[model samples]
Target chain A: MKQRNEQLPPGIRGFLIRMGQIDRRWIYLAVAVAIAAPMLARLRFPEVPGRMAQATFDAIESIPPGSRVLIAYDFDPASAAELEPMANAVLHHCASKGHRIALMALWPLGKQLADDAIRDILLEYHPEKVEGVDYVQLGFKTGNEGVIKLMSTSIAEAYAADASGKPITQIPLLEGVRTIGDFQLIASISAGTPGAQQWVQYGDSAMPDAFKFVAGTTGVQSSQLLPYYPKQMEGMLIAIKGAAEYEMLVTEKYPVTRSADRLALGRERMGPQFVAHLLLIGLIVLGNVSMLAARGWKGAAR
Target chain B: MSADRAQQSSGAPKSDTRLWIALLIFGAVGIFAGKLWRPGPLAEAYVEVVTETRVLAEVVPAPTTQGTSTDVQSAETVAPTSLEQENAPTTRVWVELDDPRFKSGELRRVEGVATEVWDERAKVDPKKAREQIAALESDAEKLSAPTDPTGLTREEFEAREAARMNALKVVESTRIVASPRDSIGIWIAALLTLGIFSFLVRDNPFYKVVESILIGVSAAYWMLVAFWSTLVPDLFAKLAPDLVRATMLPGLAPSEHPGKDFLLALIPLALGMMLLWRLAPRGAWIAVWPLAVVIGTFAGMRLTASIEADFMAQIAATMKPLVAYTSSSAEGAAAGSAFDLGGTLAGILGVVGVITVLVYFFFSLEHKGVVGKTARVGVWFLMITFGAAFGFTVMGRITLLVGRFDFLFNDWLGLSP
Candidate 1:
């Protein structure tokens, strides 16, 4: 290693070492440029839906039209950047398929996110849908999995009234609903605990065959949820990439006439994602090269 | 010492000059960039349409001597004697047109007054309610009869009954309207985001101030949310439904077993009060009891839930056939080539990883010879898993950063195309 380094030009070796020792602020600046530049350019790439994305799409599609679907917004604004796109996409997909939707939340702020989806996606695209007849908002419950357990037995007991304070019994959509089992499909867009995991445990385990279960989780939470995929979870969407792929499949099947940009949030975000990943790969390569060069330098000195 | 002091003095101004130059250059670049990347028009301002309305005054009269009497039928039949006069002043209220009651005709518009009112005349009278309940019961009985004429199923009859019961419950009508968006909020958010990013340059007062505000605001927000969403609804409503409905939640549904619910709610209320007693000057030790109870109950609940959900479920999922075969099509059944090589390899890999990881954690025996090799393999698997987790964490973090930038550009500056 020493002989090899001695044969190489000192200027090149010194340059590599200097690059390694460069200020971290410069690296931050580089990353910023890499992300911001691509975003400003409106760069976009076509997404080919993968197996997981396909599974998620199929899960919702397999259910008959007008079948009741419960979407648990288990994420808050903190993870909205990652999960909101998928939430919007899923809501649109379900509504487009004419599924009678029920929205609930585990996290306190999750209700707000659900409300945003209702306002932005559901109401915007499907204005003809009546509130009580076509859909309902169950809102947030205090008990985490306990709520799920209660719902598994009886939804009315779990939620006496909807988010608007309308009695669950009075809601035309919930008339025939006895329990969580009444829903044809259940999807949980989750960030952490008391989320998809809790749903799988308390909700799915109670009546495994009653309804199909699917989940959309943040990248970090995906590892924890991976074990439940293909079985407990009939479908799974992991992070922004998953969101983008799912969004593509959804929009392809059910294209919106107005405000198409709303559904394109995930794909638009993928531009910065591509550049950031490339920058990361570049930094990793640079760091490794620097390490090798320094090692050779040390050997030559010895 | 004099020479060293001179060198330090000379270096100080040089560093200061360099800092000033850097600041100047960055500021110039930022200004020029902002100009070059012109933003789109500001978001349109939305207005909430609030309409004035009148709601029925929810004034329950005091019980009369006749009402207190043990004659259940009499109590059910007689109207309250102290009912308020019809000439009582109506209060003015503003409700959003979006309220469901407006659509349901529960809140009807006063034609001349140009405001909606909850008709006091439409209030459910005690006698009428009894009659309605009796009628529903008779209808339900007919549906349940051996030779049921009504085609309605048992569930459908029950659902109608439930709806009737819900309608009979007395609830106060109230107004609700959303707060309009303000520019002040947007500016504050943008400044705070920038302040946070300023930390990358160096620690400064702006970053510290932003950090403190974020912490304080988040804590206060969480506390308020918990109080209103959890404690009030779950605890107070159960304990004192009428009071909660009257004051905080006008829409709180009537409970069937109020007595049982109150008794059950009292246990938690007592525990909560004890927990809060730690803030007092005396009997701080009382808090420990509730804490212990909470921890014990939580542990017990989590233990059972984890065992059933995580342990058993995961084991069931992982115990798969080592050799996975492709589902043969009707025509392909005779071909004798339905082997799914990829799935089989994945299954085998999963089994190997699980076994090796278990071997690594087995500290009962000394890790030597075959055990050492297996443990090493386990370490490799563990490393791979960790690397994947780390990559995911990084990806999630970057996405968050991207989100913040998206807000700054699209929302704040409207820079993105």
Candidate 2:
């Protein structure tokens, strides 16, 4: 045979190089299967909600009925999937409790989130609640935390009208509202600061007992925020679990009146969540195992 | 990336004509949205009415809990509407504080109430509020001024600002809005900002030392969070404030309670001040005494909480649920429940895979044994997580870049805007 330079021994090369180069699409498929199978099968993993989620739920629940509650929407489309349910649930619970809600946004895009939440949840569920009275949307303001600090004392300085350009003074819900402390409680569903921490710092810290406050945050942020829970923060809901737990709380006692399906949207999403969490965990382990196998074969070859 | 390819991409620019067309569309929307963003008459009246209703709702039981979309989307920050947009009888910055929905009379009342509070706060602590009002009012004036000192000499502008600052009225003391809460918040805000600033000094021992102090302070903060968030709500909200006062301190005045108002502020305050000493040469040595005490307390508390919340609790949750083993099938349904067996299995497998991958990290032990071989297998699993994380992180970074690009290309020159 003509001399040829083969890369390596055929069998060894096949195992080490050929097999090792598994297509990423296969992994994606595996992930899809891993996630979908559970939903199809209805796998029920025993999970008790974490304390942070419970605290968050309880914070919303604990405020005296009919108290003034300020809910700041601070996320965009990307975070809507994870945050919307809790945001909706929070709005639902507050509305149901007859709490006056002062709605506003911190992010430019956050306004859309507020608008979407209002259109989908409020109008659909609580049509009896009138705008500027049962609730008022101060719309979007651009000052970041400086707004919080200023509005802590002077609402007129920061906001004079609802998002539609209506004067807030006419709104029945915001009648006496002069400062951040005027509200009995502030519940911020935030992806990050100038959202949660800002409220805790500039909002809560500014007023102290003026209002009880809490937040709903993503899991990655929960670790950082854990220290704030139950103290500086009256309650905290961490990620999907927190959302699900809060959803359960709102729906349990006071269910959404309009859409029978609305109550369970968050819990329903948990199906995908469980699958996603498991998928990430699986990917982590599989990647580790493959490395070990590759290393072992390399060492043995030597 | 290539010109042809760029053109093929729908959003990419093609020719000058197309560019102009796009710009026209973008400009129209931006101007309209930007201009009309100012709250109008009808909207102003609506919000005023809503405020009154909310006032009553505060007294009733369970005020409507459902959040509204229009309300939620309304504000991003509380900063007053910008100076530029606030010009004349009406203008638009990123926000609008004036609207026509309310009778001018109603708005005047709202503004009057606000001014009353400010004036009251100023009266109580004239000295402090004077500074705050002066700092803000002058800034507002300068920013809003029509002339802008456009061609003024640098020294002149400085002199103008200084003269303005000097003209600011000061009194002995004003306690109206200057509550202990305000003081604590301001103080803490200053410290937090400074603490973050210290990090910018780089790796000097002075910086590291301050960082360590912050960590230690943060740890103490963790305890306070736990105690106040968990214990207080569970306790205080349930019990009488009087009971806490009697039991904890006996004859505890309103000011003495741990959570009473803003009393616990000293915990963060004294420690924060001590941290500042690290920057000063002489006080550096003694600064550590306070640092040690806080560090020790934080370390001890963190140890317990970390174990209970993170480690032990996590391990406990990991055990396969009873239903997983009983109901799981390859087909995967044990229906009616939200829990998914396949997902749980994936989790369980992930856990196992992690153990194997960890073995790969240890190169010390010879792979002659089965354990060593498994360890080698484990390393592969770890890479997958890194890859995923890398991909996700990259996506996040790219999004930021896209935002910057949007600002430059679209927002700035209105050229491709």
Candidate with top TM-score is 1
TM-score of each: 0.74, 0.42
Candidate 2 reaches a DockQ of 0.05
Tens digits of per-residue lDDT for model 1, B1-417: 577557645643455447745874885588458747774443211222333544322122224534321211112122233465445433222344455545544344434544454322222322233455566556655544343328889888778766655544311121121123534455678889888987776555678799999999999999998899889998999988878876898657678899999999999999989999999999899999999999999999999989997788768878989987786666564465578899899999999998998899998968899999999999999999999998888767878988888777765664644
Candidate 2's displacement at residue B150, Å, is 82
lDDT top scorer:
1
Q: What CAPRI class is candidate 2?
A: incorrect
**Model 2 chain A worst lDDT run, 10 consecutive residues:** A1-10
* Candidate 1: Cα lDDT at B231: 94
Each model's lDDT: 0.78, 0.60
- Measured on C-alpha atoms, candidate 2 has an lDDT of 0.60
DockQ, each predicted model: 0.66, 0.05
